[model samples]
Target: MATTNKTGAIGPVPFMNDGSAALGVPLAGLTGDDPKLWVRFYQGTWVLATFVPAIASIQQSFRPRGGDVVIASIPKSGTTWLKALAFATMARGVYPPDTAAEHPLLRLNPHQCVTNLERLYSAGQESMIEALPSPRLLSTHMHHSILPSSISKNPDCKIVYICREPKDMVVSLWHFCRRGKPDVSFSDLFEAVCQGTSVSGPFWDHVHGYWNASKANPEAVLFLRYEDMLRDPAGNVRKLARFVGQPFSPAEEEAGVVAQIVRLCSLDNLKNLEVNKPSSASQPFANDWFFRKGEAGDWVNHMTPDMARRLDAIVEEKLSGSGLSFA
Candidate 1:
């Protein structure tokens, strides 16, 4: 039998590492070459992350509170930016632009503002999360299948999922992982991504799950593209505001609420903040490394035309008949 923690859930280490108890291989370290072979599969497509122990804490324990908002994305797909936008849009009335001193965004990193359910559970903080007030802002990188049934089935809970152009995502993920993994070579990273063996991959499966779900349940899941947001931020911000049940009133729009929010959360502005600079253990990244060129098609600089074409073809094949396309 699997050992249980004090909360009566399976212990994070034993549950995830037992092959008889979980599907997929469990990773022992950070430098795995074949993530498909190293990471344990749970709920469905989500691999039990190497950094966490309590995959079952979410599936079996987490209960969604109504009006909860979740920001979902594969890593490096504009997660931090979307968190800022979502928080600003929802809290606009409470934290008007002129009230930056009182605004949480000014003092806290985006990751701190939006809690990650999996991370919280992994750290044995489920009770703390449950104590948070209604409309709690949560973030998750888990695939939809792995999310607790409480979240997926809760009509009142809203999920906003963002995906980036696959080529750009691949390049960005490679560079991002290198922050702590100096030994990882670009060639290995490229091959791992192409073969769908990187963390939280296969990439096609991860995004398409939300794409199809959004089509079936538009009211519950809002699918977004990172490049599309960059093209027209204010317009996209309005759309996001509407989805989260916080539509900006006519007067608020006239007062430039959308522009102010975007400016405050812009890459250039966020990169210069002191909260983001603190090299803390809790921060996802050590510094503003997450702010590197938020440009679309930046893959062109690093990937050969042939390299781009192959990844595109794989994405095309995987997303075929799904009625989804990323720029």
Candidate 2:
């Protein structure tokens, strides 16, 4: 007889495992305190073992509408920020960024406003995605290469990819994961990053997938860096708006809409919202988990000099000659 777990999951589920069957897939060994944090080598990309089924479904069934804007990034690489910024920018005409307290972003977590493609598919709620209005704003952690031809080859579908420095990304990911699995070691994640086996990792390949695409199709794929956004968020907002074919008009710019969007979506503003508060223990993820220190170079506080150097060397070597220097 199967036993019911605390989560109502039947049978003996692995700790931290999402309980998704990985049958027939090549699974990588667990790297953290959670024995179920398995990753699968799928289609040449390393993905969380649980997300494999969703990825397969997305690749086969996702139909991209013209003018759909897909927000792509390696996890923890300013994805939340980009989603908020993009959503605010695109919908400025409907909900003025400066004065809409009733704005969807103000009331809901950014993740709720812009659905994640894989998670939606995983939940079998893809119908929710289809029901969304056209020129929809969607988010994904999937690598560009893995995206189905319906999206990748659709010239009308725009992709905006954001990436952070590998060292900082690993640090952010460590802190983020630790919130849910406090026993997971930072060293294990750092090693996984270096070995190219972390969830949605082999970070280099994930970055390369979009980096090269952006290079080849600058108009269709907008490449962004988290560090650069910190320098001039308004500038990036303008760039994002323009790339999505929702460029700010002269009047909107004159009214300081860009500045309003920036302020509305700023980290300080979002983190304190009631909707994003740390969830109850029963919830799978607290909305607040996505609102950590959105700063660049935070790796310094968490990593030893030797650890930084080792990861830096690996990132540099893997990205060399690609004209996509993270250093």
Candidate 3:
């Protein structure tokens, strides 16, 4: 029963009726009249019910090359901070001494600095990937189940996976998930978090996959914990530098390069920057406050005791005997 407006194709949109629809393209079984499929026209085409799971699968199948340095994390798990740190560490030798502004670390959002594997592998991006120089940098949220098989087999490429405490993750996720729609209830969002139905989730599986990989090949995979980084960023930064084969110079250390990078990428600095604010060339969020309250344990303020217990139970069940627990 739904009709599309005359416009170009838009990406997938999921709705409450267990049906989904997209704009600008004709898709089978997306009509509102179908009892099983929910249909709506967003932007122009009918988004189909089947697109959600398909996109998830498609995104998961993305791969990186041997020369690539991949930053992998579940969403809202200090991904931005890790990306900045990694990017900065790699680019340390590229910039002139005492010239801070020229560093990509100072000027760009980590998302912009690193390419997503899914976007690069899409039909339009083949040429772009090919043109990139060796030792290309990349990022992805794909779980271990869907990671490109080559990543495990290839010894040349380096993978860094960052993890955050589940409580903070859920809180950050709630804020992020509600940005597009104002009325999203925390209880409903908590349900999605527990089920791993949120974007780029099934959280435990994602973390455990890399955890096992790091255990198996410590040199190939680097595991970072957000709490550890928060506690001793300088020390962790040094560790990351060594892992990437780019140890900081004694002069750089004395000049406090680690602290400089942290300050440059701090929530306050990033939030106020022109690139992150709306209307800039590199804005990462449609709305402001993307870097709000980058502290740990904020979930204690928002989650009720019952909700906390439910989330803990899910985590306990998934992490049992894995020898991995979040901070």
Give me the runs in candidate 3 sitting further than 4 Å from their true place: 1-66, 96-100, 280-289
Question: Which of the two candidates, 1 or 2, achieves a greater lDDT against the reference?
Answer: 2
* Ranked candidates, highest lDDT first: 2, 1, 3
After superposing candidate 2 on the true structure, give the runs of residues whose Cα lies further than 4 Å from its correct spot: 1-36
> Model 3, range 198-271, lDDT digits (tens) per residue?
54556777788899999989998999999898888878888887886667778778888878766766667777
Tell how far residue 188 is off in model 1, in angstroms.
1.1
Candidate 2 residues 1-327, lDDT tens each?
Answer: 433322232211111111233333333333433433557788888876667888898999999887788999999999999988988887766567876677778877788777778777766677666656566788888988899888888898899999998988999998888886786688878887888888887899999889999999998899999999999999999988888777788988899989989999999999999888776745446789998889888899999999998988987898999999886
lDDT against the true structure, per candidate, is: 0.73, 0.80, 0.63
> Among all windows of ten consecutive residues in candidate 1, which has the lowest summed lDDT?
11-20
Alpha-carbon deviation at 204 in model 1, angstroms: 0.5
Better of 1 and 2 by TM-score: 2
Q: What is the C-alpha RMSD of each candidate to the true structure, in Å?
A: 8.3, 9.2, 11.2
Against the true structure, candidate 3 has what lDDT? 0.63
Pairs with backbone N, CA or C atoms under 3 Å apart (clashes), candidate 3? 19-38, 20-47, 21-47, 22-45, 22-46, 22-47, 23-44, 23-45, 24-44, 24-45
Pairs in clash, predicted candidate 2: none
Q: Judge candidate 2 against the unseen true structure and give its global Cα lDDT, from 0 to 1.
A: 0.80
Task: Return the top candidate by lDDT.
Answer: 2
